[model samples]
Target: MNQLPQEYYQRLEEIQAIDFVLVELTLYLDTHPDDYQAIQQFNQYAQYSQQLKQAFETKFGPLQQYGNSFSDAKWSWGTTPWPWQI
Candidate 1:
């Protein structure tokens, strides 16, 4: 769940793993785009990253808002207190 207080730490690990996979696949594909294995891994990483981003935004606020703010259970507008306040 994104409910963990250690969600940031989990995110850090996920980021590192995704970065490594992306870097390795990109380097491999530089001269070998036809490598189906690398292409598959790249796609997998991209999907995983997108899921993580959604979880982060759901737990925290969006990186930025549209015309209307996202409604969250814990934080909303000025009702959201600072980290210490939480």
Candidate 2:
């Protein structure tokens, strides 16, 4: 597989980091459902992650085979290179 561009990797890293935070917050919330602060933090992270994902997809293509990421004129599923190929 070929290496993806630096920006792509950077965005992926950011997404991963944000996802980690979300997961951790989710676990905490599960145990302490009344923690409004944690819930707010989780929502913020979720929104940020969504924005990052949309940006990534807009530039680099869909991360998965499904979802609303395919908003382009042409079907990009088979055209764009996969993350592993990059």
Candidate 3:
């Protein structure tokens, strides 16, 4: 398989890190239901994740089979090289 671009891996890593933080914040919020700070941080991370996903999709195509990530210009999802194959 060919190597994927560094930016693709970097973006994926960032998204993964954000997801991890969101999960941890969710657990904390569950125990401390009134922790407004944690809630705010969680929301921020969630929005950031969405933005990251959108950017990734726009540049590299859909990460998943379903969603708004698919382009109308052409079916790039199946045609574009997979990350592992790149």
Q: Against the true structure, whose TM-score is highest?
A: 2
Candidate 1 matches the true fold with a TM-score of 0.58
Output the worst ten-in-a-row residue range by lDDT, candidate 1. Answer: 77-86
Residue lDDT tens for model 2, 10-50: 99889989989999999999999999999999999999999
lDDT for model 2, please.
0.84
Q: List lDDT for all candidates, in order.
A: 0.66, 0.84, 0.83
- Count of backbone clashes for each model? 0, 3, 1
Score candidate 2 by TM-score against the native.
Answer: 0.83
Error in Å for residue 13 of model 1: 2.1
Report the Cα lDDT for residue 44, model 3.
96
Report the error of model 2 at residue 77, Å. 1.8
**Tens digits of per-residue lDDT for model 1, 8-82:** 557656766886878888888999989998798899998887676567666655433563346576656443333
Q: What's the candidate order when arranged by decreasing TM-score?
A: 2, 3, 1
Model 2, residue 76: C-alpha shift (Å): 1.3
Which runs of model 1 end up more than 4 angstroms from their true locations? 1-4, 62-86
Give the lowest summed-lDDT range of ten residues in model 3. Answer: 77-86
